[model samples]
Target chain A: MTRAKKTWPALVALVALVLAACGGNGATETPETPETQAPETTAEPFVFGMILVGPQDDRGWSQAHFEGGKYVEEKMGAQMIVIDKVNPADRPDTSVEQVVDQMVEQGAQLIFATSDDMKDGILAAAKAYPDVPMIWSSGDSAWDIGKAYAGLPNLGNIMGQMEYGKMMAGCAAALKTETGSIGYLGPLINDETRRLTNSAYLGARYCYENYRGLNPDDLTFSVNWIGFWFNIPGVTLDPTQVTNDFFDGGADVVISGIDTTEALVRAGQRSAAGEKVWAVPYDYRGACAEAPEVCLGVPYFNWGPSYLEVARSVADGTFEATFQWVGPDWSDINNPDTSAIGFEFGEGLGDARADLEDFIAGLASGEIDLWVGPLNYQDGTPFLAAGEKATDLQIWYMPQLLEGMIGASSAE
Target chain B: MKRALRAVPAVWSVLAALVVSVGLLALAGAPPFEALVLVLDGAVGDGGRMADTLMSWVPLTLASAGLVVTFVAGLWNIGVEGQVIAGAIGATWAARTIPGDGLVVIPAALAVGVVAGAVWALAAGVLKTRGGVNEIFGGLGLGFVAQSVATYLIIGPWKRAGIASTSGTEPFREEVWLPTVGGTRLSPVAVLLAVAVIFLVWALLRGTRFGLRLKAVGANPASARLLGVPTEATVLRAFALGGGLAGLAGAVLATGIQHKLVPAIAGGRGFLAILVVLLAAYRIVWVAPIALFFAILSVGSAQLQLRLDLDSSIGGVLQGILVLFVILIGGWQALYRRGEP
Candidate 1:
């Protein structure tokens, strides 16, 4: 009996561990039949995986990607397996390769690793699964002509030219700011982030001079970067607090360049308290809904059209590794089906809305050239000689911030 | 006979945990059986999934091995997490600064990691003996300090070139990584090290004079001192031993797993090791298998999220309840024994 008693507990513990499935009890109504592929018909559905860097409902960057995934499902009749909040602060040690392995095993025909932070993991996974087609958003790995090309035959890249959108955001801020100052809530310091911040400054400078009838040099544009894409409580400086600081420091308008909508949300809260301030949220078209009254507008990426093409190509067995930097459709920037980038005016655009539209029209018709010369780097080095237009390389690999911007050009 | 019978309460606790957990799952609205199948399939259903499980097992077993020494000394060295971080920092420093490639880098960097971890743990040991600070609080405070130091290095000095972000340092040079088996991420060296630590821990705690002294000091510090056992020294040594092991785990995380020094480098594996040690009833014999079990649950729970749309945290809740039930039943057994006496 004594020996039996000793053996019993060990056996029981093992059995309990191997058998206690945690809980799929309440998940009966769950729509997560991975093998069934959501449609039990004879025809097979194209299954793709989307690994997101933040919450799907974050109302910003990841949400835009999530909507893009949904668009693929709607248009191509594909099934998507999405996992979000793939960051250390959220679930530490869950590697992108591990997630990719699971997705591929479950028959993901293509994988979309969406987030600049996912660059390393996606590349590693691409090498591991050489047969699976992969799209890495906001990555330069597939740009054979660029410096960071990985030459992975299975990997391609897709990124919207959000520079134009940032310019629009800057233009609105320039037209609306009564204080002659615009604060940009930036996300990290890299070539990509630097270029976006510089783009916003250029738009602000152009509008503050020509459209608003003020000296572009007189507009004070300060860029403050919080180390990562989104706030991670202890690890990152709070975006809300940073937005408040911008308002408190006499900047009447703050434009966000991060993955979340803290700027517009904070501005709306402050506006509710009678503060005359506004914010421009980035990444998602519907971001203005958070604080429509205080939101000047939002500069967003529409990933749908690009994602749809990838899905179709993969399904039709005509996919090849390529790098695409999609831009807004000049015909109608708000056309959901065609435009890769957009800027939707908010209720807070108020009387300056028409001016912002005219500026947009000018950009569309090639009448306004923001990247044209006489521009200087932040450190006073000449970026463009007189009347010299920036080449694709100069714009894409912006090593420093522009002149007249108050921020660190590089990490050092 | 009595020793054999002592295992009865553990068995009943497992049974009770199973029942209560199944009930909880039912209340959660998930069909318990399907969820179990989901996690089981996710865990070791194939060679690849099994490899992932073993990868998680490496750091876990290492941390648990270290904790065994501390537990034997009756020390709650909660700063094991920080020691892990210190190890990672030390290894990262070697990866970046150590010049010449292949021949000497891996073992040399790991040796540095072990030293860094040992030194970090000794600080808590010194505090407990010299400053009248409890090991728990001192360890926790130091852990926070270590975390802050790591964050500073990542975002400030060791950050990626031209990138001011806390994502992590640049990936280690190709030579810095611990070699893996042919195609998978599994490192045979990491697994062997963990196995060696288990044997080392078993031998050191049960077969040596120092082990006897540690037990004496743990049982009664004054009594051990009266018996001329050098209680404080033994305690400090116990802490160093544990912290050294934890530092090795950190090295594995850096060189073997992450290949970079991330801010959350320890990945809370230190805390999970605490659970493994506890569930093992502080017995060294159970530590390895129990650590593997927990690793399986963790790796498999991802399947729960993917297949059933259930939160991965469901696995965490089950582990917590299992531990709780074991403690509760053991308490009841103790009370029953008291009544019998």
Candidate 2:
């Protein structure tokens, strides 16, 4: 009787173990049907992966890319695997390192690392697993050679020229600055922020020196580095505080170099409260709607054409690893098939919109260069000569705060 | 044999919960199996990932081991996270200003981290034991305050001169780097040092007269006080020691993994350490494996994110659920229920 009782419990325990194992196994099998069915209906086997810096719903930086990824998916009928909010501080390549591995293992042919910080990891991954094609956004020179180089035939970088939009934004800010004193909320004092600030300053300086006959020093400028890309509580880069400081220092026109729509919203609030602050936003796209009344204009990067062209090239196998630029002629307002730099001039433009449009036309036609001489950084250092346009390298790595900005040059 | 058989249900439940939680995450648009696979690969998959996992474990284990001493003494040093940040900041400042040989630099950096961590913890200890403030609130408030100080240092006068974006201490030289093991980033010295810390903690809690008195104070402070034990002082000392260990972990993180101090150097590990303590039931020896388990979960979350396209937050959710289930299922001393009682 005792033996029988022990046998019964043992048999029950074995059954229970089998059930638990089956329950776990059931989850793994869930995707099998869909994964098989997906290939049958689509008739295409191409799987592309994207690693994002933030959540898709962020409605800003990462959101723009997410929308682009979706666009590619729709146009190419491709399969996509997206990883979002990949914290850079967590590991070397963020979450892309593992995501790419999985995508490759699952037979994904192409992988896209959507942020500049992802460049190193993507390159490392590309070299380690050469069969996968890796696309990196915002990397300056992967096509060129360096010790950190991961020489994979399938890897390349894609970027847009938003500087033209920045210049237009500066034009709006310069024209509207009642104090002739505008503040810029710059995230990092990198080459990108430098040129964007410089372009804004160049346009502002052009208006102030030519139109208003004001001395450069009289147009005070302060630039504050938030020391990071986003507001991490207990860390640096609180845009709210920085914007408040700019307003406090008599900056009536505030331009943002940071990628978020936060500064524009804050400017709207400040304006509503009778502060009369105007904001010029960058990485444009939907930024005009962020605070249309207070938002003067937004310098947007049009990624549509570039994304379309890249997708077709990958399909055709004609894609080469080159540092390609999508600018001006390829991107302007009319071209539906190429990337371009342009901004949405807001309702507050009043009568200036027509004139601004004309100026943009002239800029597009190369009649004017914003950096034409007598330009100086905030510290009175000359950056451009009369009748000279800044080179790609100059624009790429522009250092120093431009004159008349309200903020520090750098953080630790 | 029967006693061992009884433990199977508890172990099986934990496994079941982990599997279910991971499946839920996969359903939320992640590849569940791949994520779990990658997590395994990252945590113990190979030498490289294992080293990385171990690298993360050093500070965690060190903090966990230290917490055991204070936990046994019945003082909850919830402020270990702040202490860790404080230690990192202190060590960073010392490493920056003090010039020395590589050997001296490591010790100096460590000392700076330890001292800073201890001092931050002691403040809470003093308030709790003497000022009669609850240790929980005292530690919580001070943690917030310490974070602010770290912010001021990074953003204000101490901000690195030219580098823009990212508030961080200046990077230390390669010479100042802690020694590593066998071509991996796992700092051998840190491991050795951690092992020593574990032993010291085990000895202090289980061996010495001080350990006995501390347990007495923890068990019944009033009774221990009546027995002429300086219960308050002992508790304060434990608090200070615990804080120092957390701080040391922070310092190690700054020096070892990151090489420069960023505000996020602690990375919520301090809070996780408390979970480790509870899961181990404050047992000195149980902390290691529990910490490793949590580390695997973390590493695994990253894997799931990559392989399955799941969000990294999913790992945290799964861990939270598992811990919650364990607590609920454990059900307050049910394991030790007696027929007489």
Candidate 3:
């Protein structure tokens, strides 16, 4: 027994030494952070914090926001303090306040809480740090005239006018569909999603009548919400199954509004297998690269210009509490340095591409307006009087899907 | 001398884990000394950080304190996570549906949490004793079901107005939240809850005949039955008692920390408690300090990422290795003793 005890200590020392050597290797394999908060002697880079709700490379909304931060870094010699996957599902133990504390400790000057899901946490955090300028992207908490106004002086909102982008997606689906049926894969039931899906319906109805020279009444548009921005297996209805259901129901083109690209992948699979199908993915510009053959062009958010402007103002100490709902730079819609929204047409738009361009030109020139008069909501209530235009508030707080669409407007 | 001899393997286990940790820092190309300093500083660097560390300690200490009871009964209550979820659900129901305002709601909600957790665990206990199902498999299966139920409530019934997102239920009223220290997120009531639980568990295990009977059953259930111990009833009581403590931890998570019902509210702290108990060698006296050390690692991970530019998952890696080394040394000693006679 004494000999066994002696041998055990020797064996433990050997194993420990091997592990120590393994842990001591001089290699760094982690993804590169923009800049370290380590002390420096020269003029320090202007540091800012960004808390993202999903993975930074999710090829969707989070990726777009990440690229926007990278753009800010490029425009000004600034450093980014990025904390991704801050949602409850991913990092349940870590709260927004905890991450904000870390960011403040690292000497961040301005902070961006990018996601509608972070409304409560961002509000609490903004109040906690009264001097710091905090922007809650894709929220209406700072809109004084809005329904959910909190009136916090240091808190503000920044959101791209994704309404125009959705209109473009709807127009593309309308121009390309041969089955006269279109499917929309919505994320959830909210004012933001409701307005976007309603805008898509109006654009599709306008294009199917004028561009496609078809009876708009015969065109079918249906939307299905998957209860979240992305699939979480058992917790959510599988996006893959929903996309297939759309295609099997004879919808040749399906538009996606969620952060990820399930609709495009399934449509691509169906098209490759000799089915006439197409998809319009949302959020990221490079999402078409997933299945370009079946993509009907993507309507994406270009958050770079706004993020750059905010960074510059914050650096110059000229930042203020403002609700910035920026629109596309009509002069150059696809300009990375100018536009807040842009739609890049895919290769599958063989003959309808030119008509789609004409439709976009009409929208930019204000010759065609889809949000105009004589419209009814999904419940057949008068939405806008004849020849009347939609006010920003009216367009923003959209209560339901439009009359032509087939979907549950509100969860109730 | 005997006490010194008893501490030998623990000392060696900690030494091995420390050596491995330094090697890991070196592997990450980070200076080991500076990284260690950063983690230690970040964990308790200020009054606020100390509060955060203590807040993290609450759930872990309470869960492990409960684990001590189940372990003493020779029953692995893996369903602790499910019981926690059940407790949160029950607490949310009481907070939302209990009509009266803050004056009388908070304590009642916490009581509901304990009962919910106990009931959920007792059902699992019944499956083990009467239905011939192993607690491990039964507990695990029930855990999945509980998670699904939570997700359903968050997205379906308890979702925010006009929104079906799986973020969480609406935040509780400020008056209903656990009162915290001035200007900080630390709740003194939550800390007291954890301390009181540990004291109660230690007292119940050391000063009662029930504790003796539990030890007898744990050592040999067949022989314990012949000695006139009602084994099934004792097992059920252990399950209920263990689950009640887990339930309280869940209630603290909901009322004190989250202030709402979130799908992932348990935060995997239930699993972390299992590790803490294993590291303490199932000793009731050792649970608190070991849990505090783990809490420091958890709260300091954000700092590790910021200062050393290392991934925060390294903290989890360190935790797993520490437990692995302790168990290895413990099992080796057990094998040596068996060989002696």
Candidate 4:
């Protein structure tokens, strides 16, 4: 028995030594520099790695961010390392540490966590790896909107004004609705989606009160939280069915708050079947190009400029932590850089184009406050008192479903 | 004693395959060695980390130990995943509805969880014994159905009110949470409980007459039944015991790691438990160490990702490779003696 124990220790040592040697060989195999040496050009390739919450093929939330990563790689010749399909359900708390460490070891000077779920992990990693710059998408207001990032110095956030796009959708709906009724397809009843839907409603209300001269009672807004951003197989609210439910309730125009545009495709099918319905797409531009005839416009986010700015800061060594919020300048329809809401008037909206321009200009000037007071819940309880504008905090965390929304607060 | 000692080298040979798999991951631009170290550290290097590792071990041990019983009865209970999920749901439901004394609450929660898990497992048992369906497919199909049910509750009926987030049940109150070892998430009571469970199983498998009958039935069910052993009943009981243990494990996990029920509370621990049982060769004592090793791999993988700048999932890949290598090398050494004349 003693001899057997002795044999086992020797075997263990032998295995350990073999593993150590293999590890040593692995480090040596890592390439130091390329063989092709250009004498004059001095710009070293800066590696920037990204951790995505979903697969790039998700074609919605993750894919939009991936396109931004690719844009940086193509434009500035930045070496991009991307890790995808991270399970959000598990303890993703350590994922940031793992990604940051991996990326930094691979000579990445900057890392990006492209999901809201990655916020805490990214924040912790930001403090731990201060030398390596970190950026997160759709994070807390403290990170960007306030002076919180000033202390951190190495963290930054980039987000578009999604509310502007919703407004444009609402504007289009108000102009087109013969019944003066509109339906909104929302993924979750969170502050972000609520604010957007509210803005859409306000815009619709503004156009009806100012342009169409219809009573506020005639307009209806319906919301269904798909329970999640996307439908899990064999579970969750079906987005297509939800949209059909809204259309069945006599809603001519539907504004989507969900990630993917399958709802838009469903709307296109309805239009093809002679239902006379319209859809306003979110997240990406020219997505409505597939159904231009019934497509009202695209309320798109310009993540390109923001992405370039963030990457360039890393390259120039003058990057500071700040929340960068870029919105529409409202002058012309030509420049894609300035506008958060890309207004593409439908084939049927030839005469109404002038009216949309005026509304867009007014929104840019802040002449209309979307969350002004005198708002009532569907049960007629006052949400906002008369003449009371919602505070930024209240706007950021809008809890209750607004009046005229078609669906319940939660799925159940 | 000598034969037991000899198994160590064979085990290492199997583990060497795991090392090679890590190396392969390194080739894909990940740091396997560092990740491996992190996994080790995460499993047991310090008190806090050990506490976390032990916390992970509780559910794993419970399910794996139960699997040994099913294996002994010649039944593969693959539906432990679904059973665990069902158990969590039942436990969560009980925790919400059943108002009781503080002492009784936890025990009641565990009982509810175990019963739910057993019921899920027995569905497979009934299908196999009565409908003549294979336990493997029946268990797997039941597991899927259970997952859908959990998903339904999380996304639809059981979702927390006033929150517009994704599908998930309401979080458990602090009062309902199990007592932890000191302030850390690790429960001393859980460890003691698990030890008691192991002892009970060890006794059942080794010292009892039923144990011998189970072994005989597993070895040759037709012959055992011919010799007056009730094969179908033994198989069904084994499944119930297995499912009950797995359900208890699910309750522990829900009340421990997640602190709430979500659609993904099981997190594939049920399926991984199968590997744990196989690696231990269905030995209860061996499970304690092997499960710890797997947990360490998971923890160390993060460190490896940081240190080597490699993908963190290299640990999972290494785990698969380790199991594969162990089986291959163990088979080769068992069948064809290496370094022998």
TM-scores of chain A across the candidates, in order, are: 0.91, 0.81, 0.90, 0.78
- C-alpha TM-score for every candidate: 0.90, 0.78, 0.89, 0.68
Model 1 Cα lDDT, one tens digit per residue, B245-287? 9999998888888889887788777776766676676678788
- Given candidate 2, what's the lDDT at residue B224? 98
Best by TM-score: 1
Q: Which stretches of candidate 1 lie over 4 Å from their true place?
A: A1-41, B1-30, B100-103, B311-341
- The prediction achieving the highest lDDT against the true structure is 1
Q: Write the per-residue lDDT of candidate 1 for residues A1-412, one digit (tens) a residue.
A: 3423453465345334323322211122223223323644368888999898886777899989989988988877788888776776555547899899999988999999998888889999999999999999998899999879999999999999999999999999999999998999998888889989999999999999988899988999998888889986556778999998899989989999999999999999999999889999999999999999989999999999999998899999999989999999999998889999999999998999999999999999999989999989999999999899998778989889998999777665
lDDT of 4 by residue, A1-412 (tens): 3433443344344333323322321221223212211233258777787777654434456666766777677667776777654443433223455456557766888888877645555776787788888787765433544423445677777777777667777887788777666778777655566777787887888777777777766787666667666654334478889889878988888777777776677789998999888877676665676577777776766565577778898899888777665565567532554443355566645566677778887876778667788887655678899999877666655666677765665455
TM-score of 4: 0.68
lDDT string, candidate 4, B129-165, tens digits: 9999988789889988988888777665666555545
Scored by Cα lDDT, where does model 1 land? 0.84
Q: What share of the true interface contacts does each candidate keep?
A: 0.31, 0.29, 0.33, 0.25
Q: How many collisions per candidate?
A: 8, 25, 3, 15
- The CA lDDT of each predicted structure is 0.84, 0.69, 0.81, 0.69
Ranking by TM-score: 1, 3, 2, 4
Model 3 Cα lDDT, one tens digit per residue, A1-412: 5535654564454334334322321122445443453344377888888887766666788889988988877777677788776766555556788888889888988899998878879989998999888889999888889998888887888999888889889999999999999999988788999999998888898899999789998999999988778775556678889999988999999999888888999988888899999999999999899899999898998988998888788888888778889999998899999999899989888889998889889989999988899999888999999999999999999888888899888765
Candidate 3 Cα misplacement greater than 4 A, ranges: A1-42, A178-180, A248-252, A265-277, B1-25, B28-33, B99-103, B308-341
DockQ of 2: 0.18
Docking category of candidate 4: incorrect
Residue B334 local lDDT, model 2: 42
